[model samples]
Target: MIGQGCLEQDDLSSSINIMECPNVISINMSASTSPISVSWEEPTAMTTDGKRIAIFNQSHSPGTSFPVNSNTIVTYVFDDISVCSFNIVINVKQVISSPDACECEPNFTFLNCPLNITSDQPAFCGTVPVNWTEPTVIDGCGGSSSVEKTHEPGSEFPAGVTTVTYTFTDSFGNQSICEFDVIVPVVAVEDDSVPPVVSNCPAHIYEVLEPSQTSLIITWDPPTARDDSGLPVSLHQTHSPGDQFTAGGYELVQYTFTDAAGNEAVCEFAVTVYPNGVNIDTQPPTVPPTVYCPAVSYTPPIITVYVENEATSADYNFTWPTGATDNDGVTPTVIASHQEGIQSFPIGFHRTAIFYYDTSGNRKDCYQNILVRRQGSAPTPATVINCPQNVYLEIPEGTSTRVCWEEPVVTDDAGNPIAATLWQRRLHSGAEFFINGNCNEQFVGNTFYDYYGNVIRCGFSVTIRAIGHENLPGQWTQWYNRDRPGGNCDCDTTPSTACSNGEEPIDVQCETLAGDDWLTVGLIPSAPEKRGQVAYCCPRIGFYCWNRWNALYGQQCLDYRVRFKCPLQ
Candidate 1:
């Protein structure tokens, strides 16, 4: 038996085959109250004799085994003795927790929401009240009583644009906002009122000579009126005030008044200018018996004068005949129908008639005859036969010089002697005088007064003439020098020698004499000095003397040295 056992052992040992150990196995099971059943296929092995398989825990502890189809712990090791080992493992997967299902939908909505409103209304002169509708909000959760809104309904809004906001909030805090605009447009308004009330029309009557007759000044107070809207009233007239109307009968005028509302009212009045019965006297007065003459200096014989009647019943007016002269210097008078005061006639034979007129335009005239003898030959101009030479006299201030000179002989064309009636002298100082047939007269000495001082020289000339004789008019003789002898001449009585070449030289000299104390100083070489005098000088040499040396003597004298000598007075 031992030998047979040994041969089997050698055959098992030589036939021993190590199979691949089964991989680690896992078993899955749900979490439960009971233990899990673990299961795995066992690994096969080859040996000379029958092999045995055993299972143990990983610690190799004895008695730690697991049944193939029993509920137990799966972590175990299986081994074929002297061949290979296998492992088994169990994995537990618990059930996954899931969230609870939700089915809630929260939202917001706008309920009875106000829409944009546009309004067109007439413009109010004053402030206008505003109105609007409020917006309501509806939430999907419930009612929208908790919604917030801005600009409440029926609130006053200005005439322009306005905005309204509505905000809705749901129970879940979701929000919905709605907005709209309200516009109030402006519109024009019309006004209709009655026309203005006009009154105060006038009726005028005027006479011929009045301004209303010629330029008919048709004037009346401006019409007074009222307007419903308190607007100003405008007035217009067919003819303005101060407008002239022609001489005529009755006339009509109109005035129109208007108000701001375009209403008008008109008023009418009448004007009249009376016709003038008195006619204008257009016919001029009549004159008869005109005269003629060949010479301008011949005297004529005077004749009686009278006026003839030409008007019947009208009042009469008579005027003396113009252009009539008398050699005796007597003025003629004209009465109702007679003329008197006839003595001598003018050189020319002038026959003039009296002019007569009546209120009714009738006229008549009277006649006069004046016959003048015509001379056979023309008269000759007067000649200066024995005129004195230019004389120089130094009359003192407040003194005078006897202006002595030989009278010039004069004759007519017929060799008849002519009488000298008048003599004229024009001084270098622009003073002129007419001496009545006197060649020897007292010449009062004077001084030139100017703006600067008293420094002027003067000279004069003399001429003769036959008065009332046109043919015997005298000619101017040579000029003579006027000297202030011994500085003696009555300064107060002497005329001023202020010379000017302009109008009325003598008058200007007299006017400048004011405030002059007979010794008012003046500029040297005055206007008279510039005009070349013959040794002439101012008589007085005092505090106001311009040139110290007297031009008459060519020597200077002190105030004490100057003497006053009256030669002619």
Candidate 2:
């Protein structure tokens, strides 16, 4: 056995045929020893004698042949020498496992469809492990394929794309159906649709004094809706912020804005207007002066004139000096008047005055000043001219009273004693000293006044006593009063006679003077047994001594108002 390496022992090898089909046979030998001596032929045709080997169909050649060089040996001999030849057979028909095809990968798209059928295709075939077989609609000829077939072999489609048509039946009856398109690539159906957000922005403030008509200003900037990350907004009206206002008046007013997505901006401000009516001038004119009547027996002088109207909106009208004729318009009897004044007026004094115009215009006026002596005629003696007649009294409060008389010999209207015209102190209290008065002891004493307010002397008696260094020498009173108001000689009904000795004397009548009355001094502590200088403590004039001096003179105690060291327990 060489070239094709063929050897058959007991004639059972190549192309398998053993003893008339009862055994095997295979032989091919040729190493080239002798031309006719390398042979072997043993098919003498004996079917059942020794063991059966009659398999000779001419030369036995059906299909396989390839055995040339390399010592090709081709010899086959098997007359009737078969023992156990091969033979076995068992055939069945339907066997199929090869027609597989399900392609649904051509780009499908379906996220929220009519219902649902999944097939997203993204598993690239490693060697065919894909299957789906629940699609059986091949009824009659293939007409019920509206898409409801799925064979479940790795089926996962929920994105849209399907084409699986597999119909197979192999093992000889032979049948096949195939289509591949299980591809799915559209996985973006997670839409939420959201887009909008903008809160608040737009305003204006104004105040510029005065004058205005139209000052361009109206604003906005807030809108951007559709929010889901803490969203709560909804508005749609072209997102307003533009109507158009150009430039008007009074300087300082600016604006420009937009929102709702157009986004724009600008801002500025100021506007004012103010000022109105005021005018005034008050009339005043009229002057006449010149008169010397030193002889109607010599004495008479009185004249006054005034007119006015200034305004703060009192609106005015006033006229004076009527119808004149001194040069003789012939009706020359000029007379005019006006009145109204009193805001306690006394700055230039004028209570309305213009006294005199006659010629038939008749007149008789007087707004102040007029006195022409000689009516009952008789009064010419009041010459105590210089000063100091006698007056010094102080008992205004416990322990203080002085009056040292005898210094009133000052005279000059030709009575001779005018030593340098001295002394002046006037006291008249009843308006509770409404202002300047701190000469202590309410000092309304030390008197004298004469420059037409004649008093020439009413104080000069000197003698006051009440001394208590630290506390308690306070209480004394005397010099209550005597009689020295005297008679006042006159001049022209006294015309206030220049205060004629401080006037207050009408028809004459006088009385009273018996040890003067006002003397009170006290220091009592539960009556230390009638403590010192005891001047009748619990008696003399009952009512409890006038109610203990009426609680020690508290209620204006007889109009004296005196309190001396009386404040203690």
TM-score for candidate 1, residues paired by index:
0.16
Per residue, candidate 1 scores C-alpha lDDT tens digits across 1-569 of 10110011233335544444445443444444343444444433344354422221122222333322111111222221132333333323333344843222333333345444544442222223446655454444464335677776666554334566665554444344455666442221133224555656554434354533453455556445543222334554555456566654335565766654466666655455444663343332333334322222222335322212321112122234554333323333222333444444323223444534332222243554433322232244332333233343333333322234333334444545543222122221211122332211222232221111112222222222223222222332222212322343212222222112211111101012223321121212344232121222222211122222234334332222111211121
Candidate 2 residue spans exceeding 4 A from truth: 1-278, 282-286, 290-300, 303-368, 375-379, 384-431, 434-569
lDDT of 2: 0.25
What TM-score does structure 2 among the candidates reach?
0.14
The backbone clash count of each candidate, in order, is 28, 67
**Cα lDDT, all candidates:** 0.34, 0.25
